[model samples]
Structures are given as C-alpha cells and as structure tokens.
Target: MNADQVLQTIKDEKISFIDFWFVDIFGELHNVGMPSYAIDKNSFVNGLEKLDASSIVGFKSVNNSDMILMPDPTSFKILPSDYDPGNRKNARIFCDLYDGSTDESSRYNRDSRGIAYKASKKLKEFGFTHTNWGPEIEFFVFDTINVYPSPYAATHSYGGSGYSIESKESPWAKGNVSTAIDIKEGYYPSQPKDTLEGFRKDVCDDLYNYFGIRIEAEHHEVATSGQCEINLEYDEMIQMADHVIGVKNLVKVKAKRKNKVATFMPKPIFGDNASAMHTHQSLWNGKSNVMYDKDDEQAQMSQTGRYYIGGILSHASALCAISNPTTNSYKRLVPGFEAPVNVCWGLGNRSAAIRVPMYNRNQEKSKRLEYRVPDPTANIYLLEAALLLAGLDGIKNKIDPGDPIEENVYKLSPEKKREYKIGSLPVSLKGALDSLSSDSKFLEDVFTKDFLDVYSELKYKEYVAFAQTPTAWEVSMYADA
Candidate 1:
C-alpha cells in the first residue's frame, strides 16, 4: 500500500485514530496517535515528525534528540475494535526513524528498524535475494504476581522488592495442586490440564484476523507453570521480526484483558524448562532455497548452510550478548533446562546451539538450521541483523564448522568436550558482554561503532544492577552463616 492508498483506506474504513508506531533500540514499541481528520498523504510521506529521541533508551542524548517517524504504508493495519474504547476504529502503521536534527533528514543510525532494513539489503551484496526466519516464541502466564520489599527496606520504612507469581497450573497454587501439571511435563495435555488452551486459541485468532500473522501451531510447553509455545509461519527477516513484536504485544494485551499476567522473561521459574525463541533460518536466492543440497548423504545441508552454521558457532558468545540481553536470560541458558549451552552444531540435537532439523530432509524449502539460544528478551531486529551478519562472515571466509555432534552435549565428559572442541556459551551477561566487546568486527556491516557503544553501555548497566542486587536464594544461603 502507498501513502494515497493508506489515506483512502482510513476514509473508507472510518478509522478515527491513526497510530504511528516505531521501535526503540530496546525493541519496546512506541507510538503517537492522531485523529483520522488530521491525517493526509503528506503525513505518511513526510512523517508525523519531532519525536524526542533523548527520552527513549539507547537513542540520542538531549543535545541531539530530535527525530522523525516516517510511517510505512505497507505496514498499515486497522486494529481490532477491542484495542479502543467504545469500538472506535483505530489503525496503526509501523515507522522508520529519521534524523530531524539536520535540514536534510536521513535514517537514524541508532534506529533498530533502519538497521534491520540495512541488514536485509546486505543480503543482496552476498548474492542472496532474501532470508526467512521462523521464531518459536515461548512464554509463561500467571494468575497473579506479588512483590515485597527487603528486610532492610522494611526496617527503613521503604517498600519491599521481591516477587512471587501464581498459576493454577503450578503445584504451589492453592487448591489446584491436585490437578496441577507435573514439573517439566506440561507438553500437550487435554482441556482440564491445559488451562491456557482457550487463551492461546483466542490470541491466535486475533493474530490472524487483526494482524494477518499466520499461526502454524500453539500448545503447552514442557514446563509446569503455565508455559506455552506459539509457532508462527516463516516469513522474510524484517516481516518476521515485525510479526514477533505484534505477537508479543497481542499476547500481553489479551492476557491482561482476561485478568492474567503474561511474561516472556527467560527464567521466571527455577527448576523448570526455560522459555526460548528457537529461530529457524534459511538463505534464499529469488525462489530457490540455497540451504538445501539433496545429494548430501549426512544432513542434506548445502555448503552455504554449513558455512552459516560455522559462522554462528564461531560468534555464538558475542551473539549471546545481543540475543540474550537480560540478566535473567543467563539464568535460563544454564544446563539441565533444555536451553542450548554449548557452541556446536548437530543434526536433530537440542543441546547443540545450531540444530539442522532431520525431519525435513530432502524437502528443499524446509531444510534449514534452528538457532536455539535466543530468548524473547532480545530486541528481534538487532538479533536478526547480528545473526545474518555473522552467518555472512562465515560464508565469506568459508569457515569450517567441524563435525556435527550427535551425542547430548550436556552429558559429554570434560575430556570429551575438549576433544570435540566444543565450547560453552557465556555463563552470565557480563561474560557475554565481554565476549561481544572483544569480537564484534563481524557485526560492523550493520551495527555501527556508535550504536554498539550505546548498546553496550546500556546493557552493562543492566548487568551491574542485577549483579549488585541480592536475591532470595542468596539470603537463604548466607543468613545462618
């Protein structure tokens, strides 16, 4: 859709509000809405203008804060009536940020969406037309959540600061313990045990009807406390990232409407399976799948695909800083939780960071690698860009990925691991950040030096805060000593 078409649709659909939306560097959605009467073709072409970039995290500082939001008509959509009060028609369009500080506006260097666009364009330079990404989004829903202050804070007349969550599916839930799902056994139970079935269906329906995001499947995940997974149909990189944003927001909104709280935090519950966004990816040339080689006997993976895996494995530590940005994200990446902790590739091995699905062998389009390390806490745009750049670097250098490990990586002896040359992902956010700081040249194509500096600074602050804060477990371990 063009600017004119967007305006015509607004008039024809009687849309009262047009929401101009853009993502910040942290992948949080920001918007400014205007009445339909105030919208025109110029509004789309020239943008609504004058966003305070200083206020947004990882954006410009106060000295150089001005920015513009150029709405992409191709991303226009009329939101469901439930989105507004009184059923007033409201529409939304995703925007690209532009520098408003100068007379001639240009794409903002720190804008994540613009970075995604640049990353997509970078594919053409590598002789590939495009790439597709499918992210298996996992999250948890809770009935209620409560937080309390610390003992020191209570003594000082300050509020408490610890949290507790509840879910009917949890063993700790009052009266529901009898019917609660066993730990790590919530996969595909029928109606009575699967409390979120209706909820998932409703969310999926809205995703398709309102946002045009196709749902491949939705079901209970292998965790006791309301864990769920929703699979979306694969699409081009940028579009897929956009779909991720929409799906996350919709899930949260729908959960709130039903008096439940939804969280995508990687390790919300200890001693349970952690949520992860296992991204399935493939490179394409026009209509051809460049990742498939039917003649290959072992995995049927093409040379291009093997090189891509090599790139990801070589840079897995650095990539973790972006893909698992949060402090809680590290908690999820630990062993025994089904999260990939080793830097290796394997066919049909969940423990390996990159798993080439064996189920779709010889099926040209379906032959792709699943990167199993990222979580929903990541900024999808940045994560996708970094992954693509690293893979391209691998291809350019023809990096050898070594052999595919078939055995469980977590079960491998220390000596065996050393012999296989398998390395582990960073054990903490600080470690991951340090790795990224040392080895980030591969990301220079799309991630600028200035952007990296700002991003690193912001993420380091998060790491420091988490490191300093004492948790309940720490108190329990040391109070008697």
Candidate 2:
C-alpha cells in the first residue's frame, strides 16, 4: 500500500486514530497517535514530527533531539476491537525514524529500523537478493508477579530488592497441585495440564486476524512453569522484526486481559528451562535456496551455508551483546537449560550454537541454519542485522567453519572439547560487551562505530549496575559472615 492508499483506507474504514510505531535502540516499541482527521497524503511523506530522541535510551542528546516518524504504509493494520473498548477505531503503522533537526532530514543513524533496512539492502551487494528469518519465540506466563522496592518503598526502610512469580502450571501452585506440570516436562501436554492452550490460540488468532502475522505453531515449551513457544512463519528481515514486535505486544495485552502476566525474560525462574528465541535463517536469490547442495551427503549444506555459519561462529561472542542483551539473559545461557553454550555447528545437534535441521533434508528449501544463542530480550532488528553482516563477512572471506560436532557439547570432556576446537560463549553481559569492543569490525558496515559505541556504553552501565546490586541469594549465602 502507498501513502495515497493509506489515506483512502483511513477514510473508507473510518479509522479514528492512526498510531505511528517505532522501536528504540533496545527494541522496546513506542508509538505516537494522531486523529484520523489530521492525516493526509502529505503526512506520510513529511512524517509525524513530534518525537524527542533525547528521552530515548541510546539516542540523540537533548540539544539535537528532534526526530521524525515516517510511517510505512505496508505495515498499516486496523487493530482489534479489544484494543479500545470504545466507539473509536484504532489503526497502527510502523515508522522509520529520520532526523527532523536538519533541513535534509536524512534517516537517523541510530534508528534501529533504518539499520535493518540498510542491512537488507547490503545483502544485494553480496549477490544475495534477501534473507529469511523465522524466530521461535519463547516466553513465560504467570498467574501473578510481584517485585520488591515498590513505588511506595521510599516511604519505608527497605534495603533489598527482589521479585516473585507464580504460575498455575507449575508444581508450586496454590491449589490443584496434581495437575501442575513436573519440572522440565511441559512439552505438548494435553488440555488438563496445558492450561494456556486456549490463551495461545487467542494470541495466534489476533496475530493473523488483526496484525497479519502468521504463526506456524504454538505449544508448551520444555519448562513446567508456564513456558511457551510460538513459532513465526519466515519472512523478510524487516517484516519479520515488525511481526515480532507486534506479537510480543499482543501476547502481553491478551495475557493481562485474562488476569495473567507475561514476560519474555530469558531466565524468569530458577532450576527450570529458560526462554530462548531460537532463530532459523536462510539466504535466498530469486526463489532459489542458496544454502542447499544436493552433492553434499553429510548435511546437504552448500558452501555458502558453511561460510555463513562460519561467520556466525566467528562473531558469536560479540553478537551476543545484541542477541542476548540483558543481565538475566546470561543466566539462561548456562549449560543445563538446553541453551547453546559452545560455539560450533552441527546437523540436528541442539548442543551446538548452530543446528542444521535434518527434518526434510531432501527438500532444498528446508535447508537453513538455526542460531540458538539469542533470547527474546534482544532487539530483533539489531540482532538480525548483526547476524546477516557477520554471515556476509564469512562469505566474503570464504571462512571455513570447521567440522560439525555430532555429540553433546556439554557432556564432552575438557580434552574432547579442546580437540574439537569448541569454544564457550561469553559467560556474562560484561564479557559479551568486552568481546564486541574488539571483534566488531564485521558489524561496522550497518552498525556504525558511533552506534556500536553508544550501545556498548549503555549496556556496560547496565552490567555494572547489576554487578553492584546484591541479590536475595547472595544475602542468604553470606549474611552471617
């Protein structure tokens, strides 16, 4: 749809409010709404000039904070009636940030969406038309959530901070513990135990009906405590990112309407499976799958595919800075929760960082690489862009991604690991940031040096703050000492 068509639709559908949506550097969605009467064809071209970039994290300073939101007509969607229980109809469109301070008003250097656009264009320079990304988004739904240091804590003498979460599907639910799922056994349980089945269905319906984002599948994940995974159909990079943001917002809103809380945090609970956005990616050129090879019997993976995996493995440590951006994210990357801790690639091996699915090896289109390092906390645009750039670098240099590791990486002995040249990912957010500082040349194409520096600085502050703060577990372990 073009700008003219968007305007026509506004009048035809009687859209009362048009919301312009965009994301910050951290991938958090933000929007600005305007009355439909105020919209015109010029509004699409000139953009909504009301955003102050200074207030947004990792954006411009206050003195030069002016920004513009150029709405993408292709992303226009009429929201469901549940969005606003009134007579007014609401519609949303994704926007690209531009500099409103200068006369030219070029695209903002730090705009995550703009960076994604640049990344997609860069693929053509490497002889590939585009890339497809399918993210297996995982999150947790809890009956109730409470956090310490509440808004009224300043009036009291509270010295500690913590959080508590409850889920009816967990073994610790208040009533009907018999139906609660056991630890690490929540995969595909039937109706009595899988309480959120209907809720997931509702979310999927909203995604397709209202937002036009297709969900391939939805099911309970490998955690007993209300963990769920929703697989999105593969689409172009930018569109997929938009779908991700919309899906997350819809899930949270629907959960709240049902008197529940939803979180995409990687490690919301202890001693159980954690949420991860295991992404499946493939490069294509005019309907041809460039990652497939009929001659290769081992994995049926083309040389291009191997180089792409090589690039990801080479930059896996630094990529984690964007892929897993939170302090809590590192907790989920540990060995026990089926998360990828080692840097290697294998066919049908979940322990390796990259897995080549062997489900339909004969089908050329099914050939793709599944990156297991990222979680839902990541900025999808930035993460996908970084992954594409890294893979492109590998192709440019023809980097050889060594042999595949078929065995379980976690069970491998130290000697075996060394022999296989399997390296572990950064253990903490600080480590990932430090790695990015040195190994970020591959990302300089799309993510400018200034952008990377700003991102790293903000993330570093978060890591330091988390490091200095004492947790409940720490207090319990050493309070007597």
Candidate 3:
C-alpha cells in the first residue's frame, strides 16, 4: 500500500498497534509494537522501524550488539481477536534485520533467516525466481507435561484420566480403545469420531481470517489419539519461514484454551507416531513451472528437477544437522514405522526420502517433489533456505540422482541397496553435527565461524548432558549383574 493508503486503512480499520515480528535461529519470535499514530502507509509498507540485536537467541555478547528490522508489506496480517478485540487491533509484518549503522549486512551475520535470505537471493540470481514450498506441519496435543531432573521418575506420563481414553463424545475419544483399532475405527470418523475437527477448523479459520494464511486442508494423522496435520498454501522462501513461527504460536495458544497441550517435538512418545513437517517444493519462472515437463518418459520429472533431487539426496546427511537440528529428531528418523530412513527418490512412494506427488499429472502448479525428512521442530528459515541452495547446486552441476527405487526400499537386499547407492542418515545428534562441521560451505556466508561455533557448542553440551545420564534400559539389563 502507498503511504496514504496504509495510513487511511489504519484510521478506517482503527488498528491500534502495528506489531513488527521477526524470528531467531530457534524459531522464536520477537515483536515490537508501534502505535498507529506513528506509522504512515509509506513507512509501514517499506518498514516500520528497528530493534535491538543481542536480546534474541544464539547471540555471543553485547559488545557487538546491533540489528535493524525492515518490514515486508506482503506479510501484513491481522492479529487474533484476543490480542486486541477493542479499538486497537493487533497485526503483524515480517522484518529484515539490518546493521544499525553500517549497512554491512548484519543480516548476513544472523544465523538462520539471514542465510535463507542469501540463498533465496542466490536462487533469483541463478534465474530460478519462484521457489515455492508446501510444508505438512504435524503436531501432537497432550493433557499436560511436566519436567523434572530427579532420577527417580525422570520420564513419566499421566493422561489416562482425560475423557479421551473412555468418552465417546468426540471423534478421537469415540473409538479410542487402548487395545484394538476400534472394530469400528474412526480413521476418518465423522461426528464423535473426529473429536478435534471443530478445534482444528477454528484454528484454520482464525489463521485465514486474521493472518490470511490459507489452509489447504487438515485431518487426523495416523497416531489416532492426539496426532493432527494442518496444511497451508506455500509462499515464497522467507515468508514461509515467518509463517512457520506464527503457526507454532497459534497452535500452542489455541490448544491451551481447549485444555490441551501442544508439542512439535519429533518423538514425544514411544510406540506412537511422531510429528513431521515434510515439505513439498518446486520452482517456477513467470508462468512456466521449471520443475515440470509436459512430456517425460522417465519418472516424468524435468532434467533440472531430477538433478535438484540429486543435490538434495547427496547433501541429505549434512542438511540434517540444520534441517533436523534437534537431538530428538533422530528418534523420529529411525528405520521402522513410517518415517523415511532411506535416502532416495521414488515416484508416488512414501518410503523414500523424496517422492513426486502422484496427484500431479496435468496440473501445472502442483508439479513438485515432497521431501519427507524434515520434522516439525526444524528451524524453518535456515533449513528451508539450505534445501533450496543445495538443490540449486545440483541444478548447476546437473547432478544425476540415478534410478528411482520403486520397490519397498526397506525390503531391498543389502547388495541391492548398495547397487542403488543409497545411504542412511546419521544415527545420533553428534554424527549429524560432525557431518555438518565439514560439508556445509553452502552456509558459510550466513553460518560463519562464530555462528557455527556457538551452535556446535550448545548442541555438544546437550549431547554430553544426555550422554552422561544413565538410561532405564541400561539399568534393566546391566544392573541385574
């Protein structure tokens, strides 16, 4: 909007505060509010103002503390009614962090978002203008969660008392028998079977009406109890990152009101489905979709598209260090259940890490590859941006990610697996960190020495904390001796 247009909208809509939002490396959001009196269309459209730097996550010290926030108008969205149901309505705008004085690219120094920005800029520079992304963000709802350091009951759960276990009033609670899939299972149960449908729809409706995040769809995931998936339309590189932060906040808030707790943690429970944010991506230029070929005999993917998959598959191990940054993320990627343990591309196959969606035959816009490795806990900015860069690198090199494994990769013989040249992801957090330590030149400009240093240090500390502790399994088997 122009200066007058924005200013008038503020007046006409009676929006009280302009909430400037930005995220840190860990997907934490920080906001600065500006009263309507202080903003004009021109000022708000370009950027509202600046903010302090050292206050956010992954910072080293205060000596070199400086940052600026320049708002992106396209991200304009109204805040929830609860945030401001009165005269002053709340709203959000994604921001670009800049150096306070020197224009020396303070953004380049910040860890995740900055790197993603650079990668997107590079994508544009290389004639790949449209890097669209659709992430199937999954989450779980719980009754309550409490943490304690004491050794006696370090791990515990107490959700049995809730109506979900017995009551048939809701969809989830309807067929929730502990033992068997309700002989009358509610996989896609109606009425009482789909208990959380109303709550899910409300969240989607609010996001669309308030923030303009259009929902593609939402449904009950396989976990049956608390697992759910809500999909939103994909946007450009950075905006999606910003939206990711917003999505988390909304989920937590809305769930809390319904007396439920939400967790994006990859593996929250044993023997239950874990949450994943599998992303589907494709590139386009103007009206032409670059990833699509109207006629193709092999896998029906364009040459550029195939190479892009190759780059991602080759770099998959290294990408996990950032894309699947959390320690718990490993618990979700293990070989078994439904997670993608094998690195390969398959046509319409879910077992492989990458798959071309079966639904996209003639649809021009839907042509894309779904990358299944990422979980809900990823740092969307850095992770998504890194995937783009790696794929672009593959495009540049014309990296041929040979032959799709159509058969069940899990059932493939050892020699057959090797013949196809597929590799497994790191088994632990330390392994992923080690992989990233050397192979990540793509992140050099943004993840400079200091950034990686701090990240590695923090992760290593976490590893040591877990490593030093004794597990119940160890005690059960060894303590008897």
Count of residue pairs whose backbone atoms collide, per candidate: 4, 0, 6
Any runs in candidate 1 off by more than 4 Å, and if so which? 101-105, 150-161
Give one digit per residue, the lDDT tens place, for model 3 in 1-481: 5446556767788888988877776667777888878776556434434555667757635776655567666677778864553646876777776665325344436646677777777767668777888899998766565554344343444321211232232233434443222322324555455567887898898888877788899886766455678897988777777777788888887877767778888886666567889998989887778888878865568898999999999888888877787888988888665889888999988989998987647766888999999998788887787789789878888899898879988788889888989898887788888888878775665557677777777777877777776665675668779
Each model's lDDT comes to 0.88, 0.90, 0.74
Q: Record all residue pairs in model 1 with backbone atoms less than 3 Å apart, i.e. clashing.
A: 148-160, 148-161, 149-160, 149-161
Alpha-carbon runs more than 4 Å astray in model 2: 101-105, 150-156
Candidate 3 residue pairs that clash: 3-42, 170-192, 171-192, 171-193, 171-194, 171-195
True-vs-predicted CA distance for residue 194, candidate 2, Å: 0.8
The candidate that wins on lDDT is 2
How accurate locally is residue 424 in candidate 3, as Cα lDDT from 0 to 100? Answer: 87
Question: Would you estimate the TM-scores of all the predictions?
Answer: 0.97, 0.97, 0.88
lDDT of 1 by residue, 173-246 (tens): 87884559988899898878899999999999988998899999999999988899999999998889889998
Tens digits of per-residue lDDT for model 2, 1-481: 8888888999999899998899999999998899999988877778887899889988998998888888889999998776776768999999888885333338887989889888898888878998899999999999988898753343457876678878888887779565699889999998889999999998999899988888899999989878899999999999999999999988888888788999999898889889999999999998989999989999999999999999999999999999999999999999888999999999999999999999876798878999999999999999999999999989999999999999989899989999999899999999999999999999887889999999999999999878976677877898899
